[model samples]
Target: MIPNAIAVDSATGAPIVLAQAEHGAESHGAEHMASTPGEHGGAFPPFDSSTYASQLIWLAITFGALYFIVAKIALPRLANIVEGRAERIESDLAEAKRLRAESKAAEDAFLKAQADARAKASAIATEAREAVARQSDENRRRLDTEMAAKLAAAETQIAATKQAAMGNVRGIAADAAAAIVERLSGATPATAEIEQAVDATLAR
Candidate 1:
């Protein structure tokens, strides 16, 4: 069982045992804190005045090293890269201009060549037409000459045939006359006399 009663000290009329224990605990906590003041100080060493100059020197050294690397090495590398890129771009532009000029020249040359070829073809065609026309005219002239010669030969043949037919008619008329005189007069006419008489009658 636990006693729930008030405690009293007979000597000083107070609770001496609990008061002494609380006082001893408070003093012990204060002694522990005073003994470890250096541990707490170490957590924030930069706030300590004893090492302030050394921190400033280290900070300056680190900043100088970073500045040297950036200025001397990294910045030069970046500048070279930018310059090379610019040169490449300029070279590409020059090449493009040259190609464009060449293309234009080629197009002009092709057009000229096409015009020349067309002109040559037209000239050849014109010459061929002229040659064909000349040949046709020559053929017509030759045919006309041959026709004139043929017509003249036919007229000459007709005249010769008419002269031979007239010569036969004269001989037949003389024979017919001699035969009629012999029947009517009982005397035959002389051959020479008959021929002479027929010739004279034809002349009259």
Candidate 2:
């Protein structure tokens, strides 16, 4: 006969079987043990959806705080520093331009002064040369006037000596003729007779 059930004996730690009443035949029993207290062997509990939502909310709040700090505080300070640097560069360029213009003006003044000095020097030299030429001409005119006066005085002296010598020669000739008449005629000839003889001899 077939057995009707099978069971485990907890106290003896062994399996047991029971037979049917009419023929004593055996059969298979249950495969698994029953559930007990404090055991967790079933499907996991359902996911906590609210826990994930709370975590995401905290992350968003932290990220927004950081973004506000960077945008409002850090970025404006950096922008001010950049603007100040640009203004400083522009001021330096303006100062350099002014210095260059001042240097150019100084150079122009120096060149003008040099030109004026040269012109004055040339004028002084011209005046000195003209003065020397004028003095030389005056000296030459004075010398010529003195030489002419001396030459006139010498000519007058020569003329006076020549006239005196001619007068003495005429007087000597008259005395010699009177002496010749006294010797030849044994007496002095009359002035009329001498004059007639000199005229007749000159005509012949």
Candidate 3:
């Protein structure tokens, strides 16, 4: 609110009075028609040269106070918030990297374990195959030995049978010759002579 009287002179330090009638001339009943003398743009009183120093002083004070609030209060709080967010982001990134490394290590370990298991299984399978082959070969050799023994025994039995049959054949031949001689000559041949003769023929 501006008073009808203005205090503080421009240079002489004397009080300046603005009469109510003088103020009314610049208005029509209740509406403003113009601003105070030396002021431009109605309702904007800062353009008045009479109050230029005061306006500048207030402007400087307000600007300084705003600057102080921004520098000392708002800026520090904002900086702290920004720094805290930055640290949190960095921490999250580090944690993510750690987790990724752990996951990669675990994957590598699993792969190694799988490969080892496969190798062990292959070794076991190879050993089993070799064992089976060795067993089969041993069985074949044992069977061959048993068969050879059986073959030898059978051969001995055949030879013995053949010798027995041959012995009976010689006796039959002697008996047949004795009977034939008796029939033809009407006399029986001596058994001793027949046996001797058959023995001689067989020896030849």
Candidate 4:
């Protein structure tokens, strides 16, 4: 800015005024060139040096918000849901185990009851068969006793009938012989002698 003169205050010979004015003009020109570069000269917005601090600040805010949401709202809720599901699954598994144990007990009881029933039935059947056998034996013994008594009575009655028939036949024969002797020889036989003769002939 100073061309060919050494400028100074006329009285005190100070050099402050023109130097300050030249320095201010130079700083203004540099500021203008820095603010308005030519086309295709400065970097893209994202890579620009002037905006790096603002971009980093906004990035930090976004990351902090995401972290806060995950820590405070999203993660706690998800953890609660997962824990509830796990607890429910554990309770359900315990219930299932209990049910399985109960089922086993019930099945054992049922089997025992079935065995008892079968044993009872077998005992009943055995008793029934024994009773039937006893009844059949008693009936057979009773029939045999009746048949023996009837046979003895019938034999006794046939012997009595034969004795009476023989007595009647001997009398009739003695009478017939006496009649025949009277008609043929004019004589009657003695009763004692005729009886003795009939007995001897029957014996032979």
Who wins the lDDT comparison? 3
Q: RMSD per prediction, one decimal?
A: 18.5, 21.7, 12.1, 15.9
- Candidate 4 local lDDT, 48-143, one digit each (tens): 554466678998999999999999999999999999999999999999999999999999999999999999999999999999999999999999
Query: Would you give me the overall lDDT of model 4?
Result: 0.74
* TM-score pick, better of 1 and 3: 3
| Tens-digit lDDT track of model 3 for 1-204 | 123222222333232224423444554423323434222223355554545665789999999999999999999999999999999999999999999999999999999999999999999999999999999999999999999999999999999998898788779989988998888997999999988888889889
Candidate 4: regions farther than 4 A off: 1-42, 123-204
Better of 1 and 4 by lDDT: 4
The whole-model lDDT of each prediction reads 0.73, 0.64, 0.76, 0.74
Question: Which numbered prediction scores highest in TM-score against the true structure?
Answer: 3
C-alpha lDDT of residue 140 in model 1: 87
Candidate 2, residues 34-59, lDDT tens digits: the string is: 22111112213245332356567897
Candidate 3 at 29: error in angstroms?
A: 25
Clashing pairs in 3: none
Candidate number that wins on lDDT, 3 or 4? 3
lDDT of 1 by residue, 1-204 (tens): 112122123334245444434543664445334432223323464675534666789989998999999999999999899988999999999999999999999999999999999999999999999999989988988998898888888878877786676568668877887888888887999988888888888879
Query: What TM-score against the true fold does each predicted structure earn?
Result: 0.35, 0.34, 0.43, 0.40
